[model samples]
Target: MSDTPCRVAVCWLLPELEQPARDLAARLQLPVATADSIEAELLLRLGGDGLSLQATGADAPGAVRVDFVEGALAHRRQFGGGAGQMVAKAVGLRGAVRPTVLDATAGLGRDAFVLASLGCEVTLIERQPIIAALLEDGLQRAREAGGEVAEIAERMTLIQGDAITFMAQWAAAAPQVIHLDPMFPHREKSALVKKEMRLFRPLAGDDLDAPALLAAAWALASHRVAVKRPRKAPSIDGPPPSAQLSGQSSRYDIYGKKKLG
Candidate 1:
């Protein structure tokens, strides 16, 4: 699939969105501008048309392990100097966890972006052609931006294929953390869902075979397999996590296979 073309428009949130906007534009290979009439809402409207919008309160560059509710969290520095636990856990074991991570179920490259932001070389494996195409376009746009994060985005690769098949072939360097964020069924009303999340739901349906994916990830990961699950739900296959990071309605479960020193 081909990437979408970048479009030029006036952004009202220019002063606040300047750098990110420029970076987004550069990544999309479009010309940057300071249009005063464009509002964040307008950008969001246009972003629906396959453009990655940069605006206030959106996640920062290099944010590791973003929770849907954490708003937008990113790592402060690119390399070293040590920051948070998420970053540390991701980089611990002599960078074992930080080794190339295979986002087996890379829906829209959100989690993959976080992992890459945290310095872990990441490969996003998305099955849906359209979603993968959108991710590819967004990534290409980020690359064109030519900023620090844009450069990091370059390190994050996207592949259109079934993760189950890809994971089996990725043997040379097994991912220490096979990050998985499978699409689960949402019971709430559509109007209640966030605009971004709503857009993603249809493009990426619930991965009903989540248990199998977990099993596969467990087999492929060298040290640990991290999974994101809805807070109300039980662990995949009914086994509890060795450790979990909880937020409002979701959790990051760590299924430890090899002991971490």
Candidate 2:
């Protein structure tokens, strides 16, 4: 009965381990609906240590299923060095700056995970409660995913609030670089995009207000702000990028500001 339309329906696929789940849900401010057929905008699978989610399309926020933390850790390892460079670009907003990072739009938390993997303390800010719940569940799983990098995954922090609000409160520690990866509408709707993007599109909706997000990020980022856009698409507001990293279909626009020591 909250303003948020998406309801997190955790069907008991496994036995109930209520404390951690409930505690995590509370921490993330996600709505834990008791009814089985409450017409959830999203359906979340609450495991012992993590969560998996699929947008039900009625009112879900984004379509992403983060395997438990260990699963995520494996995925991170597989993502390999390309992801490492993405994290580097994020870190480089400060130009050799190793300042704390605030990932303003943490979709599936992939970028945040990468930043943490690269040894940067990451604070993830997500507005939607359901998405935050999935992230929390994923983080918990990552903690259990034992390997050389488990400790680095543990360094991530989740804050259940609007990025703008969090940035305002922590103005003093304004992140050296604020990373923004707002969801863009799929341009060429084909089987590939559908297979890969259908679920996420309904869940995240179109971030029509991405420009506002850019403005807020600029205000909060101390050294610079980097936005990931489809290679075909233009820059967020203008073409003032200090540098551009292009891929097959996406690009990273780095907007550098102050210099770092």
Candidate 3:
């Protein structure tokens, strides 16, 4: 994991969210500040819309946050092929059964939400406190939106903790499929850089511990462990994957003790 310090604070951008912002600050042990008064380079902003992770440097990319209610997620749900999506197929969502999934490194929850929308009981584990806070805010917003979004949120359980520990503790009752997308080392920054990746790289560095994490998931996953990686990137050191499905930009290294029926 990257050893970078969190250069961020909780900022309340609206009067109504001030208390929630302050409460979040206290929970995160981060000082509360305003856009004008804050010294941190990034802000966990509580605004009229919802909580957003704001990049504050002169040339920084735009703010990034989880929004499963509308926007890209909605478009994906409406237009994107249902069980034919790469992630959906990777987690064995093709047949009649929608396997229970544990998304161990659920950074922004995009894939997990898709799985949940496709009818999987998904447990999301995020280790970073700030990211977890953002996810919680988004989930709360989606739940209150009260429609299909709320129903999807009902199928997702968020755990703000380490995936390995949780896997070990819940080994006997492991989910059918464990999905992992540990932070892969990225290419050089460019105009097309994934905004979320750029913002998250500093907070949660390269997944140097990815191999260990894969081992834990492999030990506990009842059906299989699906690992997402850069298409050309070599698999992290582990028992060789039973199969791999490659796409233009990414690949799924699938490991399983027994095949899902």
Candidate 4:
């Protein structure tokens, strides 16, 4: 993704959220308008479902929203394999050791949420303003929902800044684990990719600095750095992972800095 901040505007379909939308517009230094009038590449939509993104184009799909409490995240929390899952194991979540994790990429905050649900304190870093806003709104609504999901959301922190810069400044206070899930160029057809990916790819672009991100993670993580990759994709360009943990559709390339206690 580009290091430069993304340009976006706040749009509202529901009348009740207009003031809040205006407030966000002011904070983001963007204009407030309806989706149809939005001139920016990304439109932040405040609707009943929550904060979503609407890409401006002739062939763009409908607004895509982030819902932590009621969709895939909730399903995973309810029925996912918990600490036994691949990502959990990759982050060294075994026994009573719940390592603090910094998710460098934090796209949509899915893996971060999973780690948080498994009892890790996860700090999520998303550089893109639009994605960060959506993640922030999702976390807030999840917190207000007030249940297990809310409790999990409590352990998750969202940081709106470049991960590489954040890690560079975090050398002394590095977390036990740093997770990287940089977006790769999608080779599949647009119809084949997930809706969220379709929407996000246009906004975030390919993560061209992924190798640099890994290097920064190595410098910051006290214990290990775990990278998520498509099962069939090649390893990120850098030193080889110390080990790997694989699932059906994805794999975790683990670079060990120190063993987890």
Winner by lDDT = 3
Which stretches of model 1 miss by more than 4 angstroms?
1-97, 189-192
Tens digits of per-residue lDDT for model 1, 161-181: 888878777757887678887
Q: Rank the candidates by TM-score, best first.
A: 3, 4, 2, 1
lDDT of 4 by residue, 1-261 (tens): 753344567888788999999988897777887746757766888888788888677877777766789977789988998998888999999899999999999989989999999899999999987789899999999999998889999999999998999988873567999999988776754334576776777678888889999999998899999999888888989999999998888899999988898
- For model 3, the local distance difference test gives 0.88
Best model number under TM-score: 3
The models' CA-based lDDT, in order, is 0.60, 0.67, 0.88, 0.86
What tens-digit string does per-residue lDDT give for candidate 2 at 56-174?
Answer: 66543554566534454457656666334655664573334466778888866877877777667888888766677677667766677777456866778888777766776674567
lDDT at 16 for candidate 1?
A: 52
Q: Which segments of candidate 4 are over 4 A away from where they belong?
A: 3-8, 35-41, 56-59, 188-192
The superposed Cα distance between candidate 4 and the true structure at residue 107, in angstroms, equals 1.2
Local error of candidate 3 at residue 74 (angstroms) = 0.3
Q: What does candidate 1 score on TM?
A: 0.64
Can you tell me which runs of candidate 2 are displaced by over 4 Å?
1-8, 17-41, 55-64, 68-75, 82-84, 93-97, 187-196
Segments in model 3 whose C-alpha atoms lie over 4 Å from true places: 2-4, 187-192
